[model samples]
Target: MTPREYCKIFAAEARAIPDFGAVPEIIPLYLIYRPANTVPYATIEEDLVGPFERYCVKERDGSLAVQSSSEIAQKCCAFQHWLYQWTNGNILVTDMEGVGWRITNVRIATKLKGYQGLKESCFPALLDQFAAAHRCNRYCEILGLKSLESLQQPAKPKGSKSPSLGRKAPSAQSSPQLQKKGLASPQGTRKGAVSPKASRKSTEAGEAQLAPKHKEEGSC
Candidate 1:
């Protein structure tokens, strides 16, 4: 519901401006579920055919872990950056996944913690380090966002380690001098549009080896 609402908000924002720059249009999958239903998923998402690529565009702590070489992917990352600034450092969407341009299974990290299913992702610490962890990608500038680092960051937790590049005010296209904020900058770029899918290990053969059971009295 959050993703759907956000998508609507962004779409409306884009429509309001006479000349909004090109941006990635994210379409979130809606969930239709009922308790005690036999179906695993009520609204099963269409599984991807061929090689399905999954990439982590942003980190929980607001850093660009994968500054993807693909322009589209970069735009996706910038959306996350824009959201933080749009909300005045309130909510940030991360843990992006899915194939091609449609991102699903995302995680939302915000300052106000402990909401239903978002407890792990919404911890305030993630947003606390935003001004430190975030690196301004080009699309962020295209959206008319100034260096996000210029936005005053909340004080980090005591004894937390600072980023390797340290803290610095953001520039549209330049890296600012580092200040003391606990987090790391980009480790490196994950180039290429599609990532190679890793194989998932099958369940233990031992489970299949369990003794066959007789039917319980009057069952079914």
Candidate 2:
């Protein structure tokens, strides 16, 4: 069944229960095919248990337990039930001398019409679970499935900071004191050309300095 159809069915079934509170959001179910490596028990446990422990309560016997994993337990249990119904417990469930859980029976059901729907909906949800359990993106690549990274939008470049509007713009000609301090220069005097009066005064000053030096040399 397609994920949408399965959700409808689950919702109807849940609503039929008397005294049940409002039906929660339907969790997406995924069929995982682990042909070579089984997903670890720790990974599954952590995904279902670690995040939902806040819902757990202490019993009268002082034992702590939860009714279920937050909302995802519904999805997980449903998927497990579906797997059991389809595979009849003949499927491989392996553990290499207490190393970890590994199921080698996972494969894409290409013949079924609902397969693509499940892949599009359930696979990503399953990938999220795997990712939450610290599985790398290559986990999908190994299964010949699209990784979440492939579907993500490319990161946009950061914008350059704009000038603040509060500060006043500098004027073309600054204060005379600033010019004297060499922090600012008058725009008109930037050219190398010298004024006629200033040039004449400089020439006269050079002549006056040279006359004293020339007189001393002649006297020597």
Give the TM-score comparing model 1 with the true structure, all chains together: 0.52
Superposed model 1: Cα runs more than 4 Å off: 11-22, 33-43, 55-64, 114-121, 153-220
**Candidate 1 residue-wise lDDT, 123-169, digit = tens:** 56667665576777665665678676567756567886679658776
In candidate 1 the C-alpha lDDT for residue 128 amounts to: 65
Q: Which ranges in model 2 have alpha carbons more than 4 Å from their true place?
A: 24-68, 71-220
State the lDDT at 24 in candidate 1: 50
What TM-score against the true fold does each predicted structure earn? 0.52, 0.20
lDDT of 1 at 74: 65
Error of 2 at 144 (Å): 37
For each candidate, what is the lDDT? Answer: 0.60, 0.36
